[model samples]
Target: MVNSVPDCDFTADYLTATEADNLLAHCLTALPWQQEDILLFGRTVAQPRLQVWMGEPDAVYRYSGTDFVPVPWDAQIRALCTRLARDCGTRFNSVLCNLYQHGQHSMGWHADDEPELGPEPVIASLSLGHARRFVLRPRAKGNPDRHEWSLGHGDLLVMRGQTQQHWLHGIPKTRRAVGPRVNLTFRRLLGAEVSAGRAESAEIDVG
Candidate 1:
């Protein structure tokens, strides 16, 4: 099965454990990580985890009132991007990397449906480090169905089609003592003058 959520897929063994370990080490110390404070629930608060945005110079991304400029892609990252692009049959101009230090550092529910991302964007996520619970909830009312996945090291998950519009996904906090985990979400951003192409959507649009 591609995914528990419609229009998505998960590869449990995308990379070898040894390869994952090396990449984890390189990312942990090589990349410049930052924690940004964002407006949440009418109050500004620091994000629980550290993150970095890397991509093409023109690929600017903004979220929660914070505008992010792209950092030049590292050599290792560029290589991975090339491989993923070839494998997925799509180009990704940017990647948002999030480092979860422990179980307490988590991400809240959110979709990747940004204007710059255009409609029906394909997102590729690579997981490295400890295992954690990633949850997806159907946005349609009365369905009340939710799906959860245990994302571990060297795994890859792809979300495509109208999944973003119809589902909300996040990494919730856990009480268990867990090691650090890193997530790289690759996305293709549309230029200001560009228009989105037509594509099919999921059965529901919760928002």
Candidate 2:
């Protein structure tokens, strides 16, 4: 469950199936989930899926042309982060929780290269519920190669070092009928103040 690519680590069963199911259920009911809008092509539009941003007080993250001040983490999430950090050997102060309600909901190709993430950020992504295809491709030309992995329930993937500098990763939309999936990407934000400035867009809550 490891990759030859430097700084890329994958664990197929980071959590037991029962543990993953319990955690997913807790997050669905406890976390404050919201469907955000991003400014794309000069017009704001809804994000493809629902998400909940949770972090420490200073770990506000900004991306997709919007600033997100994370809500405080739930106790379960904090404990899970502690365990994940210990296993991954990197501390995490923030997390972005994404819930794809069905096959059509997905995340497009993008890199986690926000300024607040600093250089060479370590991102630990945990997946639960339905399995989905996670893809990565090189940004540079002449390396027409693609890497794909089936991120299954309770799987964990860690990307670090120059992974973000040279690669893009995402979960593409699928037409097959699939159940909901929950993904949590843990991050460590560099020094930055939490700003009240919010992007001019609407937030749709489907709770």
Candidate 3:
């Protein structure tokens, strides 16, 4: 229902409030969340939020100068991926789980343009817990095309086609008192074999 952007879809209530609340409670205590250090501005620093990368065995992903070996998929997440495949019409082999403990935890502007994701990747983002602002802007400098949405609990946002190639998106840190939020971005990693060496270095701000 997001008409202002191309190759993007939004559903404000993807799941019933009860279902979302239950899932949020389970994820908060179940997922193995970790705060990893990432290279930013040529310096190593801890990521602002906690995260866990989960996927099929071969779905290794590399970003922000680090190679992440996929953790085995959790039962809840695997079931969600199956549902997303049916609903979004794309198969997802991997998922990046981000946990924002509060308003201060956030993601910075970056595109999911890594080579392993392929040229036109389909990204299905599911939100749980507190609502937060998600923004997108044209990657080209000063084009003035921008879009934002209040992604609340159980909302689903799908970004596909040329969205990553032409635009950059992120959730900025907010000063308001907000509760914890969890964002799951499901994706399909291409390539029959994982690359041996690092891809070209690019700064990534992930939550």
Candidate 4:
């Protein structure tokens, strides 16, 4: 079941409609959503969507050359993490929350291949609210392989094994009118440590 797509797993209905609706509403108001500045092509630009990092205190994540300290876990998110750990068979310790306010709020192509994730990281992504298109392509140039999915409410997509080592994924900006959506990606950091120095730029994105 976990190998539905070459190191990826897609569960169409991980959460019931009622559960998704309630979770989405809670996240919209309960979580502290904020736009962050990211380094891109030698320039600092605001990330297109609002995001919050939540997890254990030691799970400091570095993305797009920025080190983010995890916020204290809320009861709701902790419960969800427990459920995902059991169901996905991975002890996830952190979650990145992304809020896409509309069609214009999108993520660019990037791999979740940070050093803290270790080799062959397992990432479980749960989607709620409006449906959106997710695209994946091989990192190797000129590769013809590509995959796409319409991740709607209650869907759970898990990427594990060597997926991050070989593929880049993103949510492209859409012109069609769309409502708000939330995505929670749960992961386990391997010996995460806080760093003193900061870099200027690197490829990073949330999905």
Tens-place lDDT digits, model 2, residues 36-76: 98866567789989999898987775554677888998998
RMSD of each: 5.4, 5.1, 3.2, 3.4
Tens digit of per-residue lDDT, candidate 4, span 5-122: 4588899989999999999999999999989887676678899999999999999966665778889997988999999999999899999999999998998888887778877999
| lDDT (Cα atoms) of all candidates against the true structure | 0.81, 0.82, 0.86, 0.86
Evaluated against the true structure, the overall lDDT of model 3 is 0.86
Candidate 4 segments exceeding 4 Å error: 1-5, 194-207
lDDT score of residue 189 within candidate 2:
86
Better of 2 and 3 by lDDT: 3
Please state the error at residue 55 of candidate 2 in Å: 0.7
Instruction: For residue 41, give model 4's deviation from the true position in Å.
Output: 2.4
Report clashes for each candidate as comma-separated counts: 1, 0, 0, 0
lDDT of 1 by residue, 1-207 (tens): 223465888999788988888889999999999997765545567888899999999887556656778889988888889988998899999899999998888887777877778779999999999998888887676767888789999999999998888888889888999999999999899872232222221111221
Model 2 residue 123 CA deviation in Å: 0.3
